[model samples]
Target: MDANGGIEIERKFDVDELAVLPPLIDLPGVQAIAEPVVHDLEAVYFDTNDLVLSAARITLRRRTGGDDAGWHLKLPQNAGRRREIHAPLGRDRQGEADAVPESLAQLVRVYVRAAPLVPVARLTTIRVVHALIGAGGETLAVLCDDRVQAERLVHEPASAAWREWEFELVDAPEDLLDAGQAVLAVAGILVSGHASKLARALGDRLTAESPRNRQRPTPTGPAGNVLLASLGEQIGVIRAQDPRIRQHTLGSVHAMRVALRRLRSVLATYRSLVDPTVVQHLRTELGWLAAVLGGSRDEEVLQRRLAGLLDREDPAVLLGSIRDRLTTRSAADAATARHTLVVALDSHRYFRLLDALDALAASPPFTATAGQDARVVVPALVTKEWKKLRRAVRRATGTVPGPERDLALHEVRKRAKRLRYAAETAHPLNPKRAARVSGFAQKLQTILGDQHDSVIARERLLRRGGVDAYLRGENTFSYGRLHALEQQKAADAEALFWKAWSHRP
Candidate 1:
């Protein structure tokens, strides 16, 4: 969900042609009903050739003839919730056609990659609305009795008509939905089987719209199925976080990067299950994407870290304008980094990479070993990853407190993350053991991750304290103090990591 997105909480019911509108004043907490208002609404739904968006339970439409008329992108959330994003139906370059807004289109690029969007369904809704006013005169909800005429534009055109009621909350208590449903049930109006009017219009055709067009992963089946499942979940996170990154949502960049890294780790850890050639390509491209998201996130983290350090320092030790300088530099770097990330996301390379991922999800390139039993295959893979982390830890423990130790700890952190993901993928086979292993692996990753962050922080502090401060003619003393503080932080993380490792099973 982005800036234009909001949660849509509504309950819809199917009714007879002559279903009478129930008495509203008698419903719980209702004080009055505003006079009915009528509006004729039209919505044109769009999707790819195979109805990819439909398969994903997403709907994108260019709608007209309502108080709110534009483009609507509806994405499924929780069982009773849908996240709806609105974008103005902007004009074509020559005003010849109504083009989908870029803001909305970009959000769905992961699902719609390399496929053209065409009209799939058209719906005409004649809606009569009655506002359900609360005792305080607040419009808690609105009830719309709709007479819908739907026409399927794709694959053997068809039409259908129906009457339905939409009970949507405005500012009402969400439990009001249960009450409204009970009322509609009493009126002998059952909940609509259709998820949306478009689904109803498409009717029989929707049952035919199955994700079976893509392969389903099963734990008892191909070993590659497990890898694909893991890969698919991470891919979804990467896609879901795209718009959040655009909105500059807190921690979004880190989330996207972590997903990208997880995908790479899965490919690397399960190298025997997938084609080496395809795995290399995906791992390389995923690394590229992660790098693109990393710049801004690093600056954001450093800014916070430095700010926290400064806050804890004695007021008298604070140098002249040091805080302002840090703020200005960080802000400028973040802007540049954010712009670069946006451009990269919108680039043809990124889109092509997404297309490749979609293709991979639909039909992963599996190797001969992929057909083995997961119970045997998964444990071996998990053990292999654990050994890698163990080796890295041994090396880090052997090193003294120097640059070599810092580098070794960073390597250990990366391996720990790999082991954690591998253990997670192995969970279906042995939940108890997988959980225990994953727990220890994550503890290692977290503390070592902090150590890695401190390592980078020290390098950054050196540059800022030496070159930047020298050039700006600011006090260098505070920078040295902060550098020393970061070093201590790194030592603390190392100690914690060792303590956790000593107790590992």
Candidate 2:
């Protein structure tokens, strides 16, 4: 099962008091409809006093009397789609019901922070479910008719009742939905205006302080506009990855790290357009966040590379317990890294950083040069980064292939990354030229990145000291061989970097 949750593709419709569902078996791609199954479900929803989760279009509830009864969290994905995560309902201190699972609660920490969560609504639903089957007997979709009664539990209790129909896709194509909609329209049914039952139950209480309503206006002038746009784009990335990182989704940490780097690069590259002191402070915080995330990212990369190398080697040459050792180390590192990340997320500093980012987006402190044309200002910034890369590369190639030269090349790699980010920022103005520069910088970055990986691998191998091999009754010859090979690969990467630089644009 996906830790982040499963994607749900479904649509809802409001029905009149006497309305009935149209024949779904005859819909396109649906061969038959199974007998209806009735379920009586009661759910209690939890949220902050201010309805933070509802405003974000998220819902968390504990449901009883269902086939998959447990805790369910639904997060909005796109129009008519949601990602649903589930957890078991274990016992609490009184042996009644447990509080929210730590795993699930952590995912929402970005929204609730230190706020207390309480029961906001309770709902009882009587649902009739019919499965739409294809010719091959595969379940393609499900049609549900629901009668719902909801009671607001907090801040002046109230009760309401309603009926609705929901058509949800299983493995069927989208055309089936169009057919279903056509049939429903003929029966005088229309899509529901509210996003969910919870939304309708809350009514006007679910204030309009949504992120969409809080978006900043477009800044004027070329420089300010470009800088603001890039900052806003990266800020969105950071926010989107927060829950994914909490869920421990694959590659989420690396993606969040890259977004932080891009945001920091924009601050540095367009410093003249914003307040210098504020940009410096933000850059420092971004650097700290990136370093925290990099811990696990580096371990993940090394484990993959070493495992791949071991897999391709001859069985006779393969040393004892190499794979097991790598696995143990990787697991330990990942646990520690994730703990560090969770601690940071739960801190006041992280919340303040998020607030600072929002403020920067909404009302940036623009300098005198912010009103200039981007075509004129952006090119100069790109040129400056390119020059920095050239100087670093020259210094790297000037030294012999050793630790000094390796360090120099690492500096070159950092410069290349900055230049690539700058070129990407300039893409909106001159796409063709920016593409050339970005492509060239990426090639350099890739070569040096491999070189750095080899360095890290060799250091790890040396630290191992053949303890696992000795315990497994094998010699340490393979470890020495691997180290020698990595050293040679690092040298080859350095050579490749110079060769690629000769054709730099």
RMSD (Cα, Å) of candidate 2?
A: 3.6
Encode model 1's per-residue lDDT on 1-505: one tens digit a residue: 2347588888888888888987777778889999999999999999886787887778899888867788899887877788898987668787844567778877787678667788899899999999999989988889999999989999899998999999988877887777888887887888888788887887776754323224344457667778877877887888788877876788889999999989999889999988799889989999998898888888888888888888999979887677887888889998999999999988888888887887787777788898887877888999999889889988887998889999898999899899999998877677899999999999888998888888887887789887789788888888888889899999999899888889989
Model 1: residue 366 alpha-carbon error in angstroms? 2.4
- Measured on C-alpha atoms, candidate 1 has an lDDT of 0.84
Model 2 TM-score on a 0 to 1 scale: 0.87
- The C-alpha stretches of model 2 lying farther than 4 A from their native spots are 1-5, 94-98, 136-138, 153-160, 207-222, 314-331, 465-477
Candidate closest to the true structure, highest lDDT: 1
* True-structure lDDT of candidate 2: 0.83
Give candidate 2's error at residue 274 in angstroms. Answer: 2.6
Each model's lDDT: 0.84, 0.83
Worst 10-residue lDDT window, candidate 2: 212-221
